[model samples]
Target chain A: MSKDSNIQIQINHKPTHLPYSMTLAQWVEHQTLELPVALILNNQFIPKGEWAQHLLTDGDHIDLLSPIQGG
Target chain B: MGPSAPDSWNLYDTPMTSRLWMGSSHFPNWNVFASACELAKPGFITLSLRRQTATGGQSYWKLIRSLDIPILPNTAGCFSAHEAIQLAEISRDTFETDWIKVEVIADEQSLHPEGPELIRACEVLIQKGFKVLPYCSDDLSICKALTDVGCRALMPLGAPIGTGLGLLNPFNLERLRYRFPKIPLILDAGLGKPSQATQVMEMGFDAVLLNTAISQSVNPAEMALAFLEAVSAGHRAFKAVPMPAQPNAQPSTPSMDMPIGDYRVGAELYGN
Candidate 1:
């Protein structure tokens, strides 16, 4: 945990243990995440290409929503 | 088992096993989509190509193609006839299939069919040699207009999109079936529960078109299967014609067949 790199991720509305300094891909790989899952940071849709370049700072929100049934 | 359904539905003139049609919008993940599709058991799945996302192959295409069901692309999220017509052209060109679910909405609330716009779109598509299934209202006049333009089928909405009020107007739907016994009339949209799907099928709708009613359930896959069974049961029940309703109550167990009916008790003692 570097002085400026400790990032906080809120997963499913609860605090998660993730490195604030990690990239999106690193964070996902750390959690073994998958696509087809809606990935949002600050509530903006993150296309697949931007995962590596998206460096996390402190107190960033990461939300994943999977497909559900509807008519 | 083969390309054709071998029964009443002519839409099954192809090799798709699932009868349910799934949507490509509002889904959280494309990965779970396969499982959902498997759960949905659609005979043919629906796809669409937006001007922005249709440039190359989409990441979801490979997964959709892998499912082995015929892809019936749509012109959804389109407003006017021109845009829908263009989307149909692009979707057909890219997917190499012209089976389209045409949806053109004019109102936000009720999302009622703008009959004129739908007719215009259907006319154009019919001329272009496409198998068009227009999502229209249950109104016979609007359906007649669409049918006159050589549309193979009409999908009348049971209720507003995702309101799930199954078969809100059964009279119009039954009339539509009676009028066009040969033509396909599927109940599209507004079916939230499995029983609704069954009711539509029981009412003689050839098929159903929906998305939210199944996909947004707490257990989407299970709900999809439930709809599948419900649809099948509805279809079979329609064909079976269980029994006729009457003005008088009919006993399920006949008195003659009852073993304990020999003795007659006093009215006061029996509290008859």
Candidate 2:
């Protein structure tokens, strides 16, 4: 493994690699996710206001949740 | 005559015209769900949050938004207070609404709410400025606890979820209504027929929340209309002051002066 290899994190439980450090806000914009999404990092809710300052770390578990049919 | 006044009611200070609240789930297709919503014109529609799918549930979200009804997001599958509270926060953020249907299931088979956990969740959610509506059993004590914790509305089940049994314990439900006469009691689940909805409404329940009955029906839109009409009829019947039942039958016609005089005299005159 190269020392400069990409950082690994989990998005919606799926492992993904980022070439460089990225803030949650930038990652969200890069993914172009649907509007009205909620972010949960390691089971803690991360408000949209904090996404800009919050950086994705190695082995972080993130959940991107959206609305669906329910009863 | 002109149309009668609408029997509008308030939920958390928001006035609503329809007494029927529909759930957005289990429809064969999205078009059917949309059609049902258009037909029913419910006061509120329920939905939930889930981890993003491949398409990110964009189509579902688009349809829900287009409906233009107040959204009520639920913690349907949460089993603990912590989980329910967390899901509620996520729901509030995603749906942009503080209205949450809190369900903390204790038994998988019965799908009964864990009263303690539910009350706990409601307390935190209400303190957090969320309008909490807990789905509980027909237990008066649990209902009281929920109301004590600042739940403005209570949704007690008619039966187990998706059972379609239709108000298994009317006695308990009646007591619940009697105990909380001022609180809005919405029958939540276990309804299979429109008559059941009407029955509860006639029994003085403020409203009903339906999902499986309409969604799993052979015709979702038609069933939705049926429930709408039933709910309206029930509301009208309740407001119209229906006659009370009596142990003995009473003749509708007046017993005033008649050609045959009295029934006793006629019977005596005709006797052999």
Candidate 3:
């Protein structure tokens, strides 16, 4: 892919442009995620073990969730 | 027997000495929350999930990891079984723990648990090997339905969430306990004071899950300690076997054992 090439995707419902052919693992490593997060790609959960193998393409929806305070 | 009698209960096959399960939210700061958790030493800590913000760098997982206690991830905001099931799966995957506090709210105003949806969720989650703890109302039929669906424990609310109303229907709780003596019933939500927690414990509830009562107090840590003491005291009092209630008053001293009085009244007594 050329340096100017970009892949548009939605993360947690926000649209963003990323480097083409970026794997889910790469996307995760690039972000400052608190450890032990669950990821969803296009409404389907991608387990932590498969992040390295799973690839994110254009127009994909990614959701990252972590534990917060609850009663 | 002394006050320090040993007692323990099990939830989903895990033995725990403390019956107080706490929530880690609404504290003045994380430091106060940490202090409260350390002091309270609850049997389980309840947590939830939300979207990670770009600026959200702080990790509650760090706090949870440091505690080394049993973590119960909740499906707090989910309104449907499907939504709750999805969150439960994600929570299980992320936390690597099968324990979940399932809250399927029916309405926005009351925040009451949707009984039928909760049963469906419990059925699915339990089939998937999740140790489900369904947060339900004090209604017996709903509780029975959850149990039928294989929920490990039932968390009946004492009042509306965050209202601090505290055990709106004690009779229902008592009836539930009496009917299902073996079920592990944890009074969850609506408790505003340590005394309310103690009262529920005294009524034979296996445990109590509290958050606002401790985290929202003037002194969170101190309130946590107070809850600990109150739970212990109430449990002890329950075990001590309080005297049963009676319709008529009974005198401590026996009339037959009293000293006999002289047959004739004294001159001064007669005059009076």
Cα lDDT tens digits, model 3, B72-155, are 899999999999999998889888889999999999999999988889999999999999999999999999888888876899
The TM-scores, one per candidate, come to 0.71, 0.92, 0.92
lDDT against the true structure, per candidate, is 0.71, 0.88, 0.85
lDDT of 1 by residue, B95-132 (tens): 56778888888887767777888999999998998889
Q: Which is superior by DockQ, 2 or 3?
A: 3
Better of 1 and 3 by lDDT: 3
Q: List the residue pairs that clash in candidate 3.
A: A68-B48
Query: On residues A1-71, what C-alpha lDDT tens digit does candidate 3 reach at each position?
Result: 23424689887889988865778888888775656677888888988888998777778898877667878
RMSD of 1: 11.7
Tens-digit per-residue lDDT, A47-70, candidate 1? 556788887766777665432222
lDDT of 2 by residue, B1-272 (tens): 12477767777897778899999888999999999999999888998888885368889888887989888899989999999998998888767788899999999888988989999999999999998889999998999999998998899999898889998999999898889888888999999999999999988999999999999999999999999999988888888869988999887887687667787787799993
Clashing residue pair totals per candidate (backbone < 3 A): 21, 0, 1
- RMSD, every candidate, angstroms: 11.7, 2.9, 2.5
Q: By summed lDDT, which 10 consecutive residues of candidate 3 chain B come out lowest?
A: B257-266
Pairs in steric clash, model 2: none
